[model samples]
Target chain A: MPFTSIRELLPKKDLVGFAILALIIIVLMPLFLDIFRLNLIGKYLTYAFVAVGLVLCWGYGGILSLGQGVFFGLGGYCMAMFLKLEASSPEATAIQSTPGIPDFMDWNQLTELPWFWEPFHSFTFTLFATIAVPVLFAFIIAYAMFKRRVGGVYFAIITQAIAAILTILIIGQQGYTGGVNGITDLRTLHGWDIRTDSAKYILYFISAFLLFACLFAAQYIRKSKLGRILVAMREREDRVRFSGYDVANFKIFIFCAAAAISAIGGAMFTLQVGFMSPSFVGIVPSIEMVIFAAVGGRLSILGAVYGTFVVNWAKTSFSESFPELWLFAMGALFIGVVMAFPNGLAGLYQSYIQPWLKTFINSMLSKYQQYIPAKFGLGKPAQEAAK
Target chain B: MTTTHNHKHKEMALYIEGLTVSFDGFKAVNDLSLYVEEQEIRVIIGPNGAGKTTVLDLICGRTKATSGSIKFKGKELTRLKEHEIVHAGVGRKFQNPSIYEDLTVFENLEISYPRGRNVWGALIFRRDDEVRKKVHEIAEMIFLGDKLDSPADLLSHGQKQWLEIGMLLIQDPELLMLDEPVAGMSVSERKQTAALLQRITKDRSVLVIEHDMQFVEDIADRVTVLHQGKVLSEGSMERVKSDPKVVEVYLGH
Candidate 1:
């Protein structure tokens, strides 16, 4: 039964998509690109985590959360706190009055380690907190809103407000949170120096590995009965409710799951980029993350990764030359994508490329039929020729 | 008015008293009391805005009653959530066909199968033989057995209506409420649906709100007619149809 379900989850087409993505991320990208470029791609891949979550929450579940950056920021901060503490060992901070505490806290004035920062000293706790903190926060927000039946545009606006408020709060509490600059200069992970090129390569691989793990998990969920329920709830909330499923509970669960995934991405971002900041947790970045999912084909999980890559690649190249026009270009791109191809790149592929590819492959196989052995399942042509 | 006794309460599948729901001071369902017997098929018929649908909404927990108690199989449903009401063995079909158009016909039924309703349960819910068999059974009953893989959006309006009925059937609720099950159906489709309802409602209590008097008379064991959010007449179909007040407000138009 499990084997059948596994097969069902990864059918031929989806398996091919997964394989192609794997080839690009694990084998091709690392082989071709220099470490610097690879590291940049790795950073973009972190955002793909959030996009993947959005695929489930927004694309399939019909939830459009504009506050994902808050979860990402929380996850990043959790990891950063641990890294920041390791970097701020008493011996390293002997120059400051508060030798054991973080530099920002020391700079703020005389102080011991705050209550929240103390647990982060344990790497195990930090790892758990990275996913848990964001999920818990998401649960609170989802519970409050969904219970009251707040959704659609109102939900989106509320999530955007949360992103804004969280950013402001982080920025306002500069002393404890590292303020507008965010927790910075993260030097090591568990006594190993992270600044070396080798570390960057290793971190990139780790991020890729985690991304695939997330992809598989998302794929599994997408195939599950719950996935259909999400779709059902999306189309008709009342119908699902009358079907004896708590619609709000499903919404809350998916929202929290999305948050946990985004938080994972945020933690990876901090590790790869060596900083955690309010800049990534604000409304703009949150909306940008949504664009990543949208352009990828909100309906497609694999599309989310490709979407993140394409959009980020464009942003990098375009912003380098015309930094002022990048935002306008992004706005235009979003509008054009929505107006022309509402499903994004994935939808375009499904509608046009996939069929073309199928026919092309069939024709090529037929052309090469004589050369192939009968044993290779191209036997149909060989048998026809024999007849 | 029937006096409430313990033995009588035990036989009742649904019992509503003083049910009133007001939207901005305009009472949609005003001080209405209704009782549905176990295995009885009760139909509510009225003109537009007579609040036939509102009664179903209140019982199904879609609309909060301004003042009332709805007891489903001895459980109070007015204070319950929609899903909670469903869990207590009440299923509701909306005015329009509300099946998930994005999914397959098989998927629509599978979702309505009574199992793994919670978050973790749904995540780990497997499409084992039991689910598959039940879905196939319901599909066959709905006459979509051959079209199980077909997307629901492609189903005709009548088929969509049956698919929604099939969805509710899979739940096997003790009390099923359908609003205008054959509103847009063709005459033959309406007859087929009436037959479908008769077969499916053997053991369960059905409270249906329908406009077509023929369909209602074909299936309804008893009919309740409403006027201005109040019950105008209640009895067998012939008795309710012959009532002067019921004819004056409803059939006379």
Candidate 2:
């Protein structure tokens, strides 16, 4: 009868945090940045989607998947395949020996399209495959590992190995995939030129909206009893199992969900950046994505978004000026974060900032309450406490 | 090789037969059989490696038995999974007070409320009056009424033990299996726990594995002494104390 479900989904503190983040992305960035800068921010935001999922999968569920880049790459590749097929029209490739196949296929001396690329010709199938493929991969890994009770560091190593394997497979298969360079030169989606400035601006908003939608969903999960059980399982899995919950199923569910979310981000990355590459589907980027979640406050969805943006911004600036110091700086950031703030920025905010802000707000409210009683012509015998 | 079956067709809470388990080549529990009647408190006493804990493990589906049949209320349980075993009205508590330490005492109990066991059920579960009332009742019973908001890890070792019992109680399981519930508890805490167990066993059965002799005498309706993975003696507390075999294997050891 308490309507706790509604309150849990949109708690006051989280509502404020959500509002501030939404305002920064939707209202401030568009007004301030040019099309080029905004599009870059949009690309960074796509990674935020993966970080958000990591917060759920790694932070809450205690599943450290080091192959998230695999899912992201899978999504990006799915979209890239569709876009590449569209870009490789018979009229566009009339000069090539084979007019219909992708240019990379021409370079690799293949006259026919690969079997896998045939499905992406339909936008509908490509759309579904973008999410489904990554989730299916995640399900296989989760089901096998969780069912056998293989977790902790072993799970991390296996996933990282999978990331390494995927990168090699993508790079080695030069004919079907674009090899080291990856699938690039994507031009349009349903005949709309994605490279145009207007389209870039529109895509940035769409990406921001999708990120917030993911944030809302992640928040809902964290507030529910399922989230608490995940936390419990992370701490003591056997206890949860004896409490009448299938621990493996929960693990599989969260892992697949994380994969699906990361895949969505990957697809959006292709739409904005106009390419899908093996560069994004390797161990390095996958671990980097985890750090984005870690630095943001792995437990906080909104924090992961900010974490991704700030880290990427720093990476861009550092690499631009002092490329040599960038790796060292990144390494130190990770070490410093782990040593000083295990919970990251959100933990710091909760511990040091939130309490002070709460008292400040309470004092302001108490003063306002005195004025309210006076305005109503009621005697202020006892001052009401600001909760 | 005999099951030592007691009340074969009665409304027994648990019945295990020929439950053998081996770790590599060494037998942890060999050809073990156990029974608990409805609304009874059965305590298992044993030396260090007498398979007291292993029997509980087999019943709760933690450790798979080599060849056995476990039945609770005439339903086969050995084939069921751990969660399924719990859903079939059996709850287990580990030796080292395995409550969720990061969560508050209320949340620790709330998770075991038995209604929302599945993923979807948990997502839609609301803390309505019924849930709140039940949690409060269990908290009071466990003497944790004043510490509902306190984190479970912050409580003393004895309090954590009680909280674990309260968690099991929230599920309203027909059979409760506890391993060393008073292993690290204070003498006073042990007495309080003994009283708490007495009150809760009015309508349910409890299978306890304990080492404290005085504590055992206070709560156990029947005592089973185990040694070398087999039952050496079993009867009333006084009857088992007088048995030379039980004294040699358990009391002397």
Report DockQ per prediction, comma-separated: 0.68, 0.64
Clashes counted in candidate 1 amount to 1
Q: Per-prediction TM-score of chain B? A: 0.95, 0.94
lDDT of 1 by residue, A79-164 (tens): 99999999999999999987988999999994898898889999999999999999999999999999999999999999999999
User: Each candidate's lDDT (Cα)?
Assistant: 0.91, 0.90
* Candidate 1: Cα lDDT at A33: 99
Docking class of 2: medium
**Model 2 lDDT tens row, B91-192:** 998999999998999999999998877877887788888998999999999999999999999999999999999999999999999899998888788889
Weakest 10 consecutive residues of candidate 1 chain B by summed lDDT: B1-10
Q: lDDT score, residue A355, model 1?
A: 83
Per-model TM-score on C-alpha atoms: 0.95, 0.95
Native-vs-model 1 lDDT?
A: 0.91
